[model samples]
Target: MPSTLRSSRDRPFLPKIKKSFTYHSTTNRGLTGMKSKGKMQGKALFYWSILLPALIVMLWLTLYPMITVFLTSFQNYNYISGRRSWIGLGNYKNILADQVFLTSFKNTIVYCFSTTFLEVLLGTVLALVFYGNFRGKSVFTILLILPMMLSTMVVSSVWKTLFHYDIGLLNTILSRIGLVRVGWLIDPHIALWSIVLVDVWQWTPFAFIVMQAGLLSIPQEVFEASVVDGASYQQRLLRITLPILKDQILLLCLLRTIDTFKVFAKVFALTGGGPGNATETTSLFVYREAFQYFNLGRSSAASMITLAAVVLMSIFYLRKMLNSKEA
Candidate 1:
């Protein structure tokens, strides 16, 4: 009778001990989870601290200037006289009406398209021809890329000498061949094309390098299989190679189009938007308006127009590229 009574009393104490143990474990788990969450938050804060400086600098350099330019575009601001007046799209209206702006826009388009087409075409051809290993291939490649390494000013100086109508080497060679000495930079019709030639000569190597990299990335097994199946070079190129390189070609066009659209240095150096505005690109127009004329308002408006065009072109190419990738 005493033993049965003791057992009943022990069962009540056992339940209390079990409840205490469970409560302690749950408390520990909650504490541990909170510590882990705090650590994660600390890490996030540290990473953000590291990134903040760069973010600020980028915003200051790019975003601030862009905002300033956008605001100034709507105002008739003169840098020299410190004059400020809100004109509200008056600058854009005047620029559109200006014949000089129209001519510059047209020239920019012509130069952009012609140079991009020729460069991409020539670069692809060079890449195709030099695809395989050959004797002194490295040496030839280095030599070929030398023109691209030269400064624009240096290239302009050399070409300027060669473009001299009377004493130019090109004219001398032409005379020897019983051909007329063409005015490369003198004639208004030929001046723009001459600048295009200079641009193509210098930048074609960039496209060549890009295309070559793309070609090399393609699997050798694919080509080997094509060859084993008795596929001709043309068949392989059209059916297999071109399809694979479509993205790279589009990328090349995008890059070249953007660069060529903003052509200024060579035009400024070689012809100074002349022989009578023949090579007056939008970049030069913006520069002259901003600095030479001190018409910041008009310059900013022109810049905005150029920026819009570039954005549109970029979007078009990017869409095409994305679609190709998805396909």
Candidate 2:
């Protein structure tokens, strides 16, 4: 009877050991699962922590303003009277038909193209001339770059004085040469060109510097090899130099085009978009509508139009670049 009791107790002890082992195994599996899930959560939290602030700031600063401007373009909103009303496409239609806006847009196109082309051409020539260093080259270069280095406002002020119809230095010089005093800024026909002259004088240095750097970057061996192959100077220039500097020229054109398209300071300070509307650009027109007349709706529409023009120009430049790359 005592031996039977001992066997039963031993059987119950084995079952208890098996139950404890199974409980420990299940606990370990659950802990491993929690650890893996925690690691994934931590990684996701780290990335979101970095990206969230920038995303929020961009939404506030850039996206919000763009959306506001887009919506406002279609509304007749006056900041002064605190009056707002939906205008549909009326603002766009009015600006498109407005004579002042049309003139300003035309002037901007003429000024941008003329100044960019002439400045790039002149800069390329000057860069080529200075390619072979000689006496006084450094001094000459400093003098040449002085115009662009000066502040635009200061340049405009001085040029404004110089362009005075009667007592200006240019008119005085013309009188000395026994010629009629020409109206540099007064005449409607010549006012836009006068702005172009100021822009070219101030920006040609930038183009020159770029072209010079491009010329310097060309390998000397290539030129020497062309010479050894008996290529003429003009042939070498056409075949080797201009091809290499094409990208620099195009880059300068792109920058100058955009800057000139948005020209306001020179027109405001020198010509006041005037004598008539000769030197007016889209920027001045937009400024007048938004600030002077308090026509926010039309102003926004003109702004969008200007933006579209700039975008189209950028697209054109990008397409040209892509074509060059593919070639």
Candidate 3:
């Protein structure tokens, strides 16, 4: 009877001990989870701290100026006079009606497209021709890329001398060949093309280097397999090469289009947007309006238009590139 009474007493204490153990385990698990979450939060805060300064700087430099220009574009502002009046698209209308702006827009479009096409075409051709290793290849490549290494101002100055009507190297060569001297920069009909030629000379090598790098990245086994499948040179180029190079070509076009559209240094140093505004580009037009005439409103309006066009082109190319990458 005594032993039975003792056993019942121990059973009651055993349940209490079991409940206490369960409570401690639950508390421990909760604490561990909370510590892990806190650690993750701390890491996140640390990363954000590292990135915040650069992000703020970028916004200040790029976004602030863009916003200021956008606001100025809608106002009739003059820097010298310190006057600003909200005209709400009056600046846009005035610039659009200006014949000089229209001509500049046309010239910019022409220059952008022509230079991009020619540079890409010539670069691809050169890359193809120089694909294989050969003697003096390095020397030749170094020589070809030398022009691109020079500053634009320097290149333009050199070309300006060469484009001179009299005692110019180019005209001298024409005379030696029994051909008449052509006015490269003085004639309105040929001045723009003369600038185009200078651009092609300086930038074609950049395109060549980009294309050659792309070509080199492609696996040789792919070409070897195509050859085994009875693919001729033209067949391989058309079916395989061009398709692979589509993205590179698109990127090249985007870069060249942006650079050529804002052609100022070459035009300024070579022809000074002269020969009757034949080579005047939008960049030069904005510069003249903003600095020369102190017409900040019109300059801002022109800048906005150029920005829109560049943004559209960039978006189109970027989307195509991203889609191609995904594919």
TM-score of candidate 1 versus the correct structure, residues matched by position? 0.85
lDDT-sorted candidate list, best first: 3, 1, 2
| Tens digits of per-residue lDDT for model 3, 172-282 | 999999999999999988999999999999999999988877777676799999999999999999999989877778878888988898899999999989888888899
For each candidate, the alpha-carbon lDDT, in order, equals 0.86, 0.83, 0.86
Separate clash counts for every candidate: 0, 0, 0
- Measured against the true structure, the TM-scores of the candidates, in listed sequence, are 0.85, 0.81, 0.85
> Residue 156 deviation, candidate 2, in Å?
0.2
Which ranking of candidates, highest TM-score first?
A: 3, 1, 2
- Candidate 3: deviation at residue 309, Å? 0.6
Model 2 per-residue lDDT tens digits across residues 214-269: 67666679999999999999999999989877766787888899888888988999
lDDT of 3: 0.86
Candidate 1 residue 18 C-alpha distance from true site, Å: 59
lDDT of 2: 0.83
Locate the minimum summed-lDDT window of 10 residues in model 3: 13-22
